[model samples]
Target: MSAVDVSLRRGEREILHGVDFAVRTGEIVALVGPNGAGKSTLLAAMSGDHPISGGRVEIDGRPLDRWSPIALARRRAVLPQQHSVGFPFTARQVVRMGRAAWARTPRQDDDDRIVAEALTTCDVEHLAERPFPSLSGGERARVALARVLAQDTETLLLDEPTAAMDLGHQEEIMQVVRARADDGHAVVVVLHDLGLAAAYADRICVLEQGHLVADGAPDDVLGEELLGRVYRYPVTIGRHPETDTALVLPRRPSRASSPSAQP
Candidate 1:
């Protein structure tokens, strides 16, 4: 998916200004910035869920508005920040819903196997029979991801997919995303964890105050000065000893002392 000169507005309020972004097949692009940055809005605009006041979103060299809803669903799947199920449904059922977009098509024949694979891939197989509403936040997040995976689209747009997970699961989820990208899927994920972005994203786009400030490889884009300025906080960037990934941390004294830091 690609967006050119995209601008988003809401009730006379401009949220994004002339953002240009594109994700090629088999690549992962991460959107990163401080709170209220236009990352999510840009993603939504790319997905056609949010209207753009200017510019266009294109898929396969065609304008997004030109595609039918089902055709669009077949090309790209979106995982928003929140996961919710109004009805009482099992995890597997929630995933099956992903295939609804393929109903009446030949792809529907693969629904069962794909759903199972998605459940296992997201590590939600054990919870497949559990009620979605009954699962923990992280579990629900995984199930939600499974649903998106089951959709089986080439382009995946995810928003803060690890926000509710523990460290291990966070890494595991990104690993899934990385593997997906390696398998020729296009992925765009919004992430607050610069370390995760640095570790897994092929490129990181840094946004600040509704503008695209930087867009490039993690190593090229995640400099200490740029991050500190965009995040409006002191930060330091280093290389991870084991993985050689960027290690970003707030520049604060180890014992510096806030009541919030106290257990």
Candidate 2:
């Protein structure tokens, strides 16, 4: 999937301004920025859930509007930031819902196997029997992700997939994403955690107030000056001692200088 010069406006205000982005097979692209930076809006636009006032979204060189809803669902799947259901649906039922796009098609035959695998892959096999509403925040997040995985599309668009998870689950989710990318699927994830993005993303796109400021490898784009300016805080880049990934941390004031630490 690709977007060229994409722009979005809402109720007299422009949210995104000519942002150019694309994700290819075997690649993991991360979108990172502060609150209201248009990350979720951009992802929604990509998935055809939101309207774009200017520019176009394309899949396989064809405009997004040209494809039927089911046809597009077969090619790409989107996992939105919120997953809510009015009915009492079990986690397994929810995951199986992902295969609805192929209901009458030949691929429908594989629904059982695919849903089972998705549940297992997301580490939600145990929760599969429980009502989705009864699951914890982290468990619900994983089940939602399994639904997306079961969609079995070439490209996956995720919005804050780990926002509710613990440290271990966050790493596990990113690892699953990494495996997906390695298996030749395109992955685009919106992440508030810069450290997580820097650790797993092949490329990072930085947005500040809806404008695309930088797009490149994490090491190139996540510098002290740019991050500090965009996030409005002092940051220092360091290396992880174990994984050796780029580590982004706030440059906090010293104890003697900190307001909270004053004697």
Clashes of each: 0, 0
What lDDT tens digits, residue by residue, belong to model 2 across residues 137-170? 8899999999999999999999999999999999
lDDT of all predictions: 0.95, 0.95
- Which pairs clash (backbone N, Cα, C closer than 3 Å) in model 2? none
Cα-lDDT of candidate 1: 0.95
Model 1, runs deviating above 4 Å: 256-263
lDDT of 1 by residue, 1-263 (tens): 89999999999889999999999999999999999999999999999999899999999989999999999999999999999999989999999999989999998999999999999998999999998999999999999999999999999999999999999999999999999999999999999999999999999999998899999999999998888889889898889999999999999866648667788
Instruction: After superposing candidate 2 on the true structure, give the runs of residues whose Cα lies further than 4 Å from its correct spot.
Output: 259-263
Per-residue lDDT value at 37 in model 2: 90
- Model 1 TM-score? 0.96
| Window of ten residues with lowest summed lDDT in model 1 | 252-261
TM-scores for the candidates: 0.96, 0.97
Q: Which residue pairs of candidate 1 clash?
A: none
Q: What TM-score quantifies how close candidate 2 is to the native fold?
A: 0.97
